[model samples]
Target: MGINAHFELGLGGFSLDAGFSAPGRGVTALFGRSGSGKSTLLRCIAGLERAPVGRLEVNGEVWQESGRGRFLPTHRRPIGYVFQEPGLFPHLSVQRNLEFGWKRIDRSRRRVAMDQAVELLGLGRLLGRAPGGLSGGERQRVAIARALLSSPELLLMDEPLAALDLASKAEILPYLERLHGELAIPVLYVSHAPDEVARLADHVVLLQEGRVIHQGGLNEALTRLDLPLARDPEAAAVVEVRVAEHDERYQLTYLDFPGGRFTISRRALTPGQRLRLRIHAQDVSVTLNRPGETSILNVFPARLREMAELNGSKLLLRLEVGDAILLARITRKSADHLGLRPGQPLFAQTKALALLN
Candidate 1:
């Protein structure tokens, strides 16, 4: 039971034709630039923008089907929608704002408890505060709690962080991560920021000009050199690792993945704690033979799985290390000099990696 949607709409000079299906769990991000129809697609699924020809199903429930003449009105749909701004009642206290939706659902229909919502968003401290007195991040947290109190089967977030500045976005991101970790409902998040998608999304739907260019797991979708995302200089591969050990003297933490162990600045993580790492392709270098006595601490033997020309001067190689995949971007000259080919074993070294949640 997952989401399946197809929508085609023509308004003025813009036309949108897009369809995609994603697992009904985890965070599925609708990623694209402005005017790319991310919001329009969400609206179509929510019944706010009725496309003459469209179909939508969420968690095995049919929300719309134009061909069958079945359509659920916006209010009838079981969804929690969060907009760019926290649209809380300015006059209402945070507790009452959260209860606004909670009080509307029938007791027999309630799936989410009031205390659960409050705890999940850490609203205990702000419950008595007015919306106007809360910070941007705090207000958004209240907004999300309000949405959750409705007991929705699905959550739709339309650039929830877009209106917040850098610091506010940072402040809210951990709360969003906690929500992703604790909630069971499927979340459809819309955003143009690549970092947000990389950090929060488990699956991705890449939209452009009102069409889906690609859709798949976050790691696979972001590492394809052919896509605009991978073409960026900051494009990277994401991997999950567990805390292996920590060196008190060096102030470093060791994380173990299928490929190998990664050494990074120390974090407040206990042993065996799972962490996500982003390894930039630019930070990786390819070598035919293993290097010794080098400053780079992360190196592993990898088999070249595939190669693609990224541009006139650069090439992208997809390598398999143990059970994990790593992407390396190297110059065409280096590739030619090394005579790189599929099935060949080589050493890959990384000078930088970032921990993402």
Candidate 2:
């Protein structure tokens, strides 16, 4: 399924003029920093905010058409939205809060079972509890379950983890991934976190000043040297890998990427398990010669393809490894010291980067 929209709206002193389409499956992250109009664009799609000259179509269904005078009401749209806050009713129990949407529909149209939603979100234990009694993460889980139970054809999550702390964010991330992997519904996830985007998104839509700057697969858009986010100190290339083996002696899990194997800090990762690894640009170094003695376990031969200035003194390099590309950021001094240039053969060392599985 795909979503296409062209919106022109004025809110407060700023005006929004933007358009983009989301991928059918996996998370299509609306990525940008603050004041980029990401939230406003989401609201337009959700039918909460309307534009006089706007058009929106999801999964081949036209929710809005400016010229045709067609517009679908928010309640009538087959969409589920989870905002930054859980927004649960304090007086209602978690179970009752989840069931609020159920009463709006006829019994025959409700396809989502309460038991399935509870199990999917691990909300069975919290059913009897009030919203005030639950933690931030628990409340978010309940919110997700409630949204799922609404039987939406498309799910729109606008910074769902933004209100939580680091630990709380970590707690809810796995459940989000599970929902994506197991469910048939497509998700449009909005966030500024590149790490989260890299971890969860199969496709991406990068917006800036209410305009679409980039839209494609996450790897292609993220690895591009032109985008501002690619110049971040924490900029990294995300690779989907599979578990190859486990070393009992070292207590390490071996994962296979396109070029070679990588040993990461994971355990009980059975063979054939799919995983993602974020190889940060700063953590990667290019070596002209292979070192004999080193603690680094990952060193793959790659050819330098492109180089761009991260700043005046620092440079970012794009290296090719089979069909996949890896990013490395280094100083101009180091580049000149190592005589690095495009088409030069180099060994990339990256063993300290975080591995999320």
Candidate 3:
């Protein structure tokens, strides 16, 4: 249930003397700033970068051990890798390119069939088209499908959406989510984007200077103000919510969390569906008392759990509402003027940027 590794490699002027263990299932993100050895670590795991004195075991299987002289080649290892680019063959049609992996992998050992891969990645339409004819998002989907078709035990994605535009990323994210949900393979996803990590990863491994600084549930790591990621102006908390009601008249979807109901901009979500919502700290405002007339539709009475000075005059407040934890960033003057303290009751107000189902 763990991927343990001890790497020792040199990359030009920088050397990677790092190691970390990722979970068996779910998306384990390799998160860090650029040039933090995230990709190098992944490449080592994939056997692309050989470690002079390294050991790697996935799900208790020893894939590599430098001391013992045991090392499995990249193709022999049950791994599917998706790089930043689609890496689709321009010469071949999408279907042919997908079949290339199937041909290389043992025919008897393949568990994921091509039909399922095509269906899962929505590659049915693009299969007949050439790579040049398909869009960036489409090419990425084809790449994922190709990897899945190989029936790999582990999936490694190295900033798969980094090369794409916002629209392309938006187009590909849901497919990635579906892949995570449907497939049984353990995924090691590399990314520097906090938003991407928040939306996708169930487990997070924060990398700093070629070492794992923090590793835990995504919600916990993301909400910690001590981490560098928390300094982001877009810093937020993720909440799991279930669909409560959908009002066609008002064009709003009501989602029920542990503490309150949130109305988000969604139309296709059905009742009983579940979704994770990102609520930014800056979007939240604290009020000493509930106001009578406010434009904010979502307001929950919360008790301040902790408060800490952020920048010179900014303060970060952690509040608990029932089982849900919320974050609010306020000015130190506002915190003092409102007499905010631990266990003080306050209202956390937010607009309809909520997650729906």
Q: Residue 246 lDDT in model 2? A: 85
In candidate 3, clashing pairs total 2
Better of 2 and 3 by TM-score: 2
- State the lDDT of candidate 3 residue by residue for 3-56, as single tens digits: 888899887887788877778888999899998889999999999999897999
**Candidate 1's error at 170, in angstroms?**
1.1
Residue 99 of model 3 has an lDDT of 97
Candidate 2 residues 174-228, lDDT tens each? 8888887888788888999898998889888888888888888988877899986
Whole-model Cα lDDT of every candidate shown, in order: 0.91, 0.87, 0.87
Each candidate structure's count of clashing pairs: 0, 0, 2
Which candidate achieves the best lDDT against the true structure? 1
